[model samples]
Target: MKANETIIVEEQLSAPISVVWDAITNLNSMKKWFFNNIPSFKSEVGFKTQFNVKSEERNFLHLWEIIEVVPSKKIVYNWKYAEYSGNSLVYFELFENINNTTKIKLTCKITESFSDDIPEFKTESCRGGWNYFIKQNLKNYLENS
Candidate 1:
C-alpha cells in the first residue's frame, strides 16, 4: 500500500489532553469507548495484545503490537488480523487545543492491503469505522463522562 493510503480521523474533544490521554492509554478506560474486548494493552513499545471483533457474522482476530509511545502525546501500534495477510500502523496523537480541549488525530496507515474481497478491509470502511469511533463514540464518552 502507498503511504498516502492512510485514513486519518480527527476530533476535537471537550476535555483536557490528560483526560484524553488516559482514556486512550489506560486499558480499562479504553474498553469503555475503544474496543470492549481488548484483553490487555500497554503504552510501552513491544507490548502486544489480541482481541476479537465481530461484524456481519464474521469474526476478526485483531493483533496489535505497540511500536512507539510518547506519553500523553502519541502512541503507535502495528495493527493486523490473525487471519488476514495485511498489516497497518495505527497512530493516536493528542494535541492540546485552546480552552483545555484536546485535538485527537488518528492515523491508520495501510502498510499492506488485505483481501479486497472482504468489504471490511476497504479504505472507505476503515475510514467510516474510525469516524464512528472518534467522532461519535469517543466524543460522546468524553463529553458525557
Candidate 2:
C-alpha cells in the first residue's frame, strides 16, 4: 500500500470572507469556474455531488462525497474516480485576515496504492491543476464577481 501524501495550496484573496465563502458554497457561483458549469453541488454535509470533467482528449465522471461542512469556514470531501483504485480527501479552509481579506487553503491527499504504472502517481500535474483551478480561476471569479 502506498502511504498518502498531502498537498496544500494557499492564496490570499482581496475579497471578504463572506464573499469568498458564498462563491464556494453557492452552486451557481461554483459553476462559473470550478466545475466549468457541470457541477451540481450541495454544500450540506454528507451530501454527494457528481461532476463532469473534460480535458482535450478525455472526460471524467467524478463523484465527491461531502464529509464535513461548516458554514463560511471549512468544507471537506472524499474524491474518487471509477477507474482509479485509490481514494482522496479534499479540504478547504477559509481564514479572515486582518486586512479584511480571506485566506483560502486547499489541501488534498491521495490514499491509494500507487506504483510506477500509474502516471498520476508522484506527478506534479495534480497539484498544478488545483493551483490553476483554485488560485487562478476561482480566485479571479470571486474577486471580480
| Per-candidate local distance difference test | 0.92, 0.79
Error of 2 at 71 (Å): 1.1
Which runs in model 2 stand beyond 4 Å of their true positions? 114-122
lDDT of candidate 1 over 49-137, digit per residue (tens):
99999988888999999999999999999999988789899999999999999999999998887788889988788899999999998
**Positional deviation of residue 39's Cα in model 2 after best superposition, in angstroms:** 4.2
Q: How do the predictions measure up, each by TM-score?
A: 0.95, 0.88
Point out where model 1 deviates above 4 Å. 1-4
RMSD of 2: 2.2
* TM-score top scorer: 1
In terms of lDDT, model 1 sits at: 0.92
lDDT by residue for model 2 over 6-124, one digit each (tens)?
A: 88899999988998888888888887878765447778888887766665554556878989999999999888766556678889899999888999999988776545455454447
- Model 2 TM-score is 0.88
TM-score of 1: 0.95
